[model samples]
Target: MILPAPIPDRVDVVIFGGGVAGLWTRWRLEHAGYSTLLLESSSLGHGQTIASQGILHRGTKYAFGKDVSQASMELLMAQEVWSRAIKGVDGPDLRRVTVLSPTTVMWTSESFLSRFTGAVAAGVLKSDVKKLEGDARPAAFKSAPKAVNVWEIDEKVVDSSTLVRELARVVRGPMASLAPDAHTHWDLPGMLSWTDAAGRSHATHASAAVLCAGVGNESLITSLAGTTSVPGAAASHVSQRRPLHMVMMRGAPCDLFGHCIRELSDKPRLTVTSARDADSFVWYLGGSLAEDGVSRDESTQIDAAKLAVHECLPWVDVSRASWATLRVDRAEGRTATGKRPDTPIVSHIAAAGHTLAVWPTKLALAPAAAGRVFDLLETAGIRPTGVIDAGEPALSPAPLPWNEGGVRWR
Candidate 1:
């Protein structure tokens, strides 16, 4: 049975945010004997964690112009780390986690560009991609036209909700809720205090603090540092937003976990993953469709999804499918060109006191982010203190994004 935990007067570390990055960091630090407290403004996975398509990318999508860039190598390393964790060999044991698909398929139309992409992928990721013959293809593609080509790639898909639940089960911190507009203060010597909505002021002393709150990190850093930007003699903190409009379809004809490749594009034309509700199969779409959908209205986006699906999968009947759209922003360290960062971003602001701000560019890179945090703490000479057993109750877990009830269907 679970027990209540009271606020401790002190801790070795204080974490802000309950998402994957925050939870993973807590797990790692606590394992080393550090006392920790996690403060959450809302339910866990309420943001990008739940909004994601749950794809464990394998760098196939980032390959461009016959070369594998730093982004591609980072994804390959992430895959290795995640594979060990999922297999319970190293890191957290995720053996019980739900894996929606063990592998994903990549298919393309019969065209010059399409053939070129297949060749580049084959040369770059030779062992990772396998071409199938007539009878070896999946049933969904049996009805496809003669000109279509299909290849299987080594990428896995997981149930985001299930993954979050498993991570929460292993977290060691006493998770607590923070009021929407709670007032928080930080002092020079590592003292932190906050005023809850009930007008009760709680204070805690920590050796250090970390922020894994994604976009919310901006305001929190500004408020605590008393400046719009965190400026240090060594480094400065800045963030950028990349938004996506994702489409979801219920009652799909079949369960498909794959990507549709097009000629002359570095990204997939359509990326699809399937999950089951009580009675029907649901399809989640990402990739180029989601990135481009950001500029279109809801109705127009849904119509566009229908056309894309029909064009890509001629055998599927989408006329009876019900559609919905979800918009989410990806937070990352700002780049000179304002493009997405290839690797996770972790920044330390000595000028702002004992604080570290982190952004895991992709869900697959959570392990890498945690490793960076660990390195930062070690570099600062911060050691784990004894664990604290505060008697306060645990914070409630965040509901799945789909459960929030704001999904608009047309």
Candidate 2:
């Protein structure tokens, strides 16, 4: 469709969006030894990548209950995401080393645990499933057997932004160039910069392009060539169920000897996570506070969030707690029956013929997702993994069960 011709056509790839999906795509593509150029409408990590709750998501959390359909769609696959991040790339500067510590996550009911077991049988859940009869450990969740059942698993909190920066550095090389604090315009098989606060503009080109923009997929579709139309409504699903996680840090240990995964206050729609970050203990609270695009007022939202976070963990004095609010929009198509479209929706603009359109779970799938796109390019076809949804379903497929007296993690 009107790709820039100034740069040589030999360029292998052009990537849009500079967050986890985009940057990770850049890193993996460069390592695969293809000449690549990355462009973004705004600065990198301006999207959800930075807003992530910071869990390498073990996929174990998906073991909610018996609904295999929901569990399969929700399968953490994060294990793979984390695994690849640490594999193949090894250097002191690279985040090759990851720390996994013992943490306990509990579901208060056996009925819920049974649903989880059914999910495992359906391949939706991925973890060691056990049902217990008595109190669990971690000192935090330990209680009478009927009170709770905990699954002690390995979890790690890697530096998400640092991960992206490292990937960018690796892509650019030791003496390579970077255009941080820059804006880009995609003009099919290329990039054009008209102007910025810095003034003046420049142009560059590439062979193929990947649109890694998450919620901003709409703008990319309108501007870039080969991008198919992804209606604005679908993209905003994430913003519709916006949850604000306020992580209040105070009196957290000097060292993060391990991580904590307590069951924060309940929100049927979202997950609120509290754990020890770096040098401070954090009380993270979030859920479906905002529904269908009508989010809470910031001042009021902050107050409500503080109270919720403090309820579960009293150590965090909301008044004295230092805080940061992380917001993320859910993008799944829906969650009623837990059925997403069997395939992800990808569009190619025949006019520009260089850009591509993608949405939904595409963010969670990142690098491997990119690799699949590259393969499709070589074969002149598309292979979609799954569609998007807004937030977790009310009754997600139950994963394997874990509690007192049913079984153990031996």
Candidate 3:
């Protein structure tokens, strides 16, 4: 058996949630000498982080047209930040983490509109895109028609599970699992209080409290502030959920990561990633197919995915493949148009320095979210007191997405 660690009476900062945003913020704060504690109601990376496709996007997805939006710029910055982290030369040492692919491939069937899109993308991406000649293409595309056009991009894919573990290891103090009744209160100046699972009351005079609970943020804030809306915003802070139904196939024909492009659509027809499962390989499908699969029943979705694979990748032999579906939601700050936000969102109760809430719009933007949180803490006059020792209350890590298995394979 296992035992819970003794809770500390006080700390400089109390962070709620243990997803990428929370973990990255805690790591940054701790390294900056803050006495910090991370509280999670469940395991780390229990939601968005683990469900991510692990793509270190470089704004290439937004390069479909001539004008790049603000979201594209954020992605560009995120790409550079993640590149440094993965290399371990600048930011956190992510060199020890598992990288599924150092680069991703983009390809399309030869057509006038498709060629135009590729040209526009190439012009926008510039040096980020490298055209692949006849023999330079991946072997998986060997069966592809001769009219296919392919290019390589500087995007990378990392194992999200390993990424979270690495961040958790860098934290100074142990993370704790919050009790169901662990109500947080911060209306009073310079005070934070909550109850533990054993019905024990605990209060801390923390400099700041950060909520990085993603979809759980709304309820958490409402419980503490008596409202879900943050003060001084155009409107109440609301969250939107974008759902995805991803398809997975075991016994993949080969290892591959690439996007299948078509003439009319800006988004890819399919995005595929390969991962090792025991001795065999598994192919995970996402992008447009996953988005559309949300409305489809399991059998219909699997059939659609299989048809997509057959059409886009003639080389993939799925005759003996076992299929599964994983449905998840992408939570983010609500927009006026109810579309996805282009950047991370950080908001606090107006003039109330004691608490703040954050949503990393994309997994690639976690570092950027940390920077914003640091800024908020600074604006609130919150500063790191000192380093906390490693031996404090410890929380168990979140299980890997596949290990937790909500997937129903057919």
Candidate 4:
């Protein structure tokens, strides 16, 4: 818990949420001379951001398709943006952020479609994939079957905890955590009134409002819809939640960051990223396994994970490894067909008095999402008129998902 800070009664913009998208937007706007105040009802990165695998995708994942997808293009641009920022060469300096892996591997099982995908991905991706053979392969893949092909894709992975910390460090305004009931009455045009945990009512008047609340965006959008005079404006601003039952294995045999590609599958069979968990290491599983595991119970998900590891990486031993499951929702902007969105979405509700709703469909797209916000603000003629002095941040970065407690490993 953070000590209370003096809340400013007014700002240029009032941002709702503390996830990566929210933090990034605050950083960008504040640096661009806009006065902003970020309000969070929970700890920073409490939802989708912290739960992410932290992969800065360089378009390799989308290369299996017939042509370059919108997601591929967005992520490709995002990788360069993130690389510059992390190297302190351009954008917001993030030199202190830790890059967990310089490149993640992609291995394919011996099959017609798998081999075809391997060839197509190598051709389509802007970033080159270096095929690792013989001794060049990591220990985890050394004993893999001869038919399995492993290529190192130039995708960077960062430590989510450090990323959040660095972003929060750069923001110029106060990031206060609001109470559960702090989804206060908005004074429509500019007023934002909410009560803190101390029962003190605070109000702020902003030139614009930004919603980056992830799943929490649903209610906020509904409220915005109620205020707007434009019919069907709410339809474009709605949120969707795609569930994922991710499997985690503690005491992983070896450090590995890669995706397992199978026959006729565009998505990875299992996307694993190793992270330091207390005194041990954890293999966090995602990809098709996670998407399909949504309907599975905890015990069944673990069983599926075990079987996946055995089939995907036969060399690795997880016989004694403890397993757990984390259920999370991938919050995104609602699409017409309810399918996954290919790019970051940024919508402006002009009728709702300078309100904008944003969803960075993937972690890699957060920068692009912020860029869109800038575009919207520019189009609306909103300028940085003054500065807001709200003191220091009033909330701390949330714990890593593995360390958040309540998981029962077996």
Report the candidate with higher TM-score, 2 versus 3: 3
Please give the CA lDDT of all the candidate structures: 0.78, 0.43, 0.78, 0.82
Candidate with the greatest TM-score versus the true structure? 4
lDDT of 2: 0.43
| Model 1 lDDT per residue over 212-279, tens place | 88777776776766642445422224677889988989887667888888776677889998888667
- C-alpha-based local distance difference test score of model 3: 0.78
> Which candidate wins on lDDT?
4
A best-first ranking of the candidates according to their TM-score comes to 4, 1, 3, 2
Q: Per-residue lDDT of 1-410 in model 3, one digit per residue for the tens? A: 33555556678888899989998888778877888778888777887887787888887876774345787889889889888887887777788789999888888755677767777676767778898877788867777776677889888988888898787776557566777657777753466777665567767677788888887876676675453354543224556678889888888867788888765455788898878888777888898899989999889999999998887776657799889888888878778887778899887744345777788989999999999988877777777888677553366556655556566667
lDDT for 198 (candidate 3): 59
Model 1: residue 226 alpha-carbon error in angstroms? 2.4
Locate the minimum summed-lDDT window of 10 residues in model 1.
Answer: 227-236
Cand. 4 Cα-lDDT = 0.82
Model 2: how far is 221 from its true place, Å?
1.8
Error of 1 at 407 (Å): 1.1
Q: Which model is ahead, 2 or 4, in terms of TM-score?
A: 4
Predicted candidate 4 versus true structure: per-residue lDDT over 101-162, tens digit per residue: 99999987667678777766666553568888998887788778777788998899988888
Worst 10 residues of 4 by lDDT: 180-189
- Displacement of the residue 210 alpha carbon in candidate 4, Å: 0.4
